[model samples]
Target: MSKIIKKIFISTIMVSTTFSLLMGAESIEISPSIDKKIFHEQYVSVTVKLNNKNISKVLIVTDKNEHYPIELTTQCDNVCSKIIKLRLGENSIRVEGYIGEELAYEVKNELYCASQAFREYKEAPIKYKERFFHTDKNEKLCAECHDMSNNEQKKVAFVDVKDSNCFVCHKAITLDRYAHAPSANWLCTSCHTGEIENKSKNIIEKSKFIAPKQIASACFSCHDKNKQSWDTKKHKHFPVEAGMCTRCHNPHSSDNKMFLRVNSSFLCLECHADKKLSQQIRGNSKCPGEQKDGCTECHNPHASDYRFLLKSPHVDKKIDNNIKGK
Candidate 1:
């Protein structure tokens, strides 16, 4: 009789343990599963579904350092379901369910914030439109893939393509370098189109692409008529022969007017190398033997309305003619 009592007691203990494990498993269901790569600053919503109608009260606990807990209650007939919003960095949620005054089940599972889920979602889309702008063979080909049926979306894509395609070809040059290049920034695209089979096979074809004369033509694309008129003048700077605008002028701003690379006399002395010219000008005295005399007293670096880049009173034609007559 004592042996029968002992066996019955052991069986009862086993049954209680099995019941407790099953109830613990059924207390919560979290979706999307858990993993690493969860960040601390994202918002998340967690839902808990209760198993037995007898379970009336639920208590939740989390690590206070990472997340704040928010209590949620939903009514259904006589029973209430509870949800707790928890923000935990490296802690688990503990859920304790109670029936009236008795504890029904105690369960725990790891918690993850929404930031991890968002990162995974972002990675899943391989071709996100926000990051890459697409182009085609004619380079007008974005309309083929973009949604043409939707007018608003089509306009947005067209604007993005127009603005971003320049960067695609000119990526090799930094903005500062482009700004200071002999031909200004906007004209870089007219010549260096990146297409294969041109005389310059591509933008990378150094020997053909960096030809000084072709770079000059890039400026003439907009200024051809102006250059043609200037060429008619008898005296011209040698940069006209070498096709080098940067020889006389910095394409960007300068402390001196007319965008000349230096003050007038210093600029002329670059080629003249005359010690008298430097000494005469360095003393802040006027140029010798002429009124309003300076480098501009004689020559024009660029084509001039007057004979020598000169202002009104100095625009004389007979000075050189009379000197030759002597």
Candidate 2:
């Protein structure tokens, strides 16, 4: 019985020694460090460390789409350190260790990588930012659709006005739809000079001019032909001459047809206070008094060669030729 006990103890000790030797033969340790945050389109370096003497192979697992690993190997007496170069975007890196016939352990480093491309880019030409104007998300001007040349004058005007920030707030105006060419080379500053007021009490005020009719002047800058035609007609509205085009026309595209502030006869009657003329119109005659045939039967919203803002020859001789002709 003693002989049997001694034999069993010897067998157990041998088994323990063999297991320790096997573990030591295939030992591997890895240390990985990466940036906490990454921007779009940037490079990242992953550092790896191992403890085994004869490492046959090392594999790094990452997303197939974004990063391709560039393997770098450095060897010391018994240890090795590797640097893997990774491309931008989000990816994960896992280091695999291998011996001659045994699969060791794996160390995983997960990271979110992004491209830093946008940080070095310039501001878009048509970019606009408005805090209180829009309830929706602020619209950014993308250079994709906006014209860079049209913004040159606006840029200069911004500099002259000393409110370079204005370009940042107003949407870029396109010249594609203009009926005529722009007059006064880069003339935005000539009309919009007084809109921004200096609030600083320390600086002496330069001038106390009425706000230049920015909206009207903007229209006439390109539509000088329309302005001249309208001015030649009789019964011209004072605001049109005063450069208050926005009182009737919206600069931006509108759901309302003709880009008028309000649609239909109500748009006309808003200022045309004649009560008798309001009652005669058949469709949507919401005006207060007796409307005549229609507002357009007499007046031209834009411009006409005739007096009293008439677009065409009037039907009735009494109203058209006799009464108003005088």
Candidate 3:
């Protein structure tokens, strides 16, 4: 009986040793991401997809053994993923996998991130689809589109992708389906030259285009023919008063009436706060009783163009106090 017990113990030890030797980091794969710029971005998304189901636990170990557990989801049968955020510059990530707390495999890789937006090389532009035939063929402006006898522009033969150059061929934005009054009348200098030319934008370098504006006054330059300022309105939509014209209206032209980015009903409810209350407040309009059709059923979006923009008779006009009013 004692000999039998000793034999069984010896067999168990042999099996455990064999299993350890057979266990390899073969099936495990660690995908690495290349260095990327994160200019004006919150975080550099460094995703490392690990493929191996045997790994039950994963960790992203950075410098100083700072272990961050990787939260993974199954993409397919044998794939796991987690996005890791790293600061700018050299990052050393050590990925380790475990089978129920026992370290099974490990992978080491180096990655770099940058917060600057400078590129040493860029792909040459071969696809210039914007070179469509111009409708107006009175080509008197030579310097506008072409390099006049090599005045030493960056590209001698090719027209650089500049808005000033674009106007030479694409001057017909004003003739759009629903052209803006300023654009249709060829009044480019008002908005583009005075406002846009001075503004800084994504390039962070000096350029001709104006920086995009957020203040309402920029759009009010032409949109409100009455020259009525949002500040002076008795009742103003939050976005309109805030000068977010681009929120609802398309910048150029649209097939939709009034150049709306989307249908009015859907656009209004996006920020109206309460959907059920909005339906009650809007009341039944000429619309065919589709409650989901939203706030534009009766209310004129820009202002109280629809009978003083008052609350619907269906809605109990109440103030912030939440008390019902007539």
Candidate 4:
């Protein structure tokens, strides 16, 4: 009888230990799945389906290294859900479920805030997509952030109701860079007018300056044609004449001087690569040749009165020989 009682006690202990281990081992299923590439909204609704019932707490970590606790509606039944706001660029998120003070399980997901960026190469960065505007995918919230009414005219100010404005989310774009005049002055309506009426900001894959005429209208609207040297100069850069300013200059902001797409001399070399003139220009005695500040030393970027867009009419024999490869 004593042996039988000892055997029963041991069996009960084994079953209890197994049950405890099963309860401690936790896992989760996230809705919308983890594979979703981009979320266009400033706020994303996430639903987490849990496998364990004892998970009493939840924590969320953002890409910016922000940590916050989200209250779960149901601990066991139904789905645990939370609305999360995302920052610009890539967002790496970690969702951790906890029981008491101990971490039960953790999972990670990645998302992107779709906004317009430079489209120099064949594709934009994997984390970012080239989009026309920054409106919410749902709710069509243009009025929440932008100047929808024509009363604002050229100036776009933040709406007083909910702290909504362009800079609220997109301040990173111009950080540590020289912003364009119109961009710096909150003159978004100057260029972003038309077709934005009551529409969502989901205009991805559409190039902002798709047409040369549109580009000309947006640029020359602020830069008066009468003051420009293009008309006065005999020789003109084809991009300038064609009203394709974006080919050479970034419309928003740039680290490079004069909002150039790249450093001055290298920018000139990008197009001149086909001519095999990079080496000749670099070694030429008549040229300044410093990568950062050379091309503009002798050549006028937009146009010039002299041939070869030379800054001055007096051209050197060496320069002429370098150009002709004599």
lDDT of 3 by residue, 169-286 (tens): 3343333478665444434334443233233333432223232435356576655664364345456665665555666765555556777645666555455538646566767543
lDDT for each candidate structure: 0.45, 0.44, 0.47, 0.60
lDDT of 4 at 312: 81
Better of 2 and 4 by lDDT: 4
Best by lDDT: 4
Which structure is stronger by TM-score: 3 or 4? 4
Q: For each predicted model, how many residue pairs clash, with residues at least 3 apart or on different chains?
A: 1, 15, 2, 0
Give the Cα error of residue 309 in candidate 1, in Å.
7.6
Model 1: per-residue Cα lDDT over 1-326, one tens digit each: 69999999999998897677546756543322222323222223333455566666666566463333323344332222223344433446665666676666756666444221122321222221111112232222323332322122311233333344333333323222223432233333344433333443433313212234234565576569968977776545566655566456544434456555556665665566674566666676554423544577665666655654443434365566667894
lDDT by residue (1-326, candidate 4, tens digit) is 69999999999998886556444424665653633355433456555667777778878788688886777763326356566777655678888777788666777877666432222332325754433333333213334334533333345544441232444434444443798876565555566554432233465544332233236667886677633758878888887887667677766678887887667766776666653364765565444545445778778888888878888866655578878998
Distance from true position, residue 48, model 3, in Å?
34
TM-score of 4: 0.53
Q: What is the lDDT of residue 285 in candidate 2?
A: 39
State TM-scores per candidate.
Answer: 0.33, 0.34, 0.37, 0.53
Residue 117 lDDT (model 1):
17
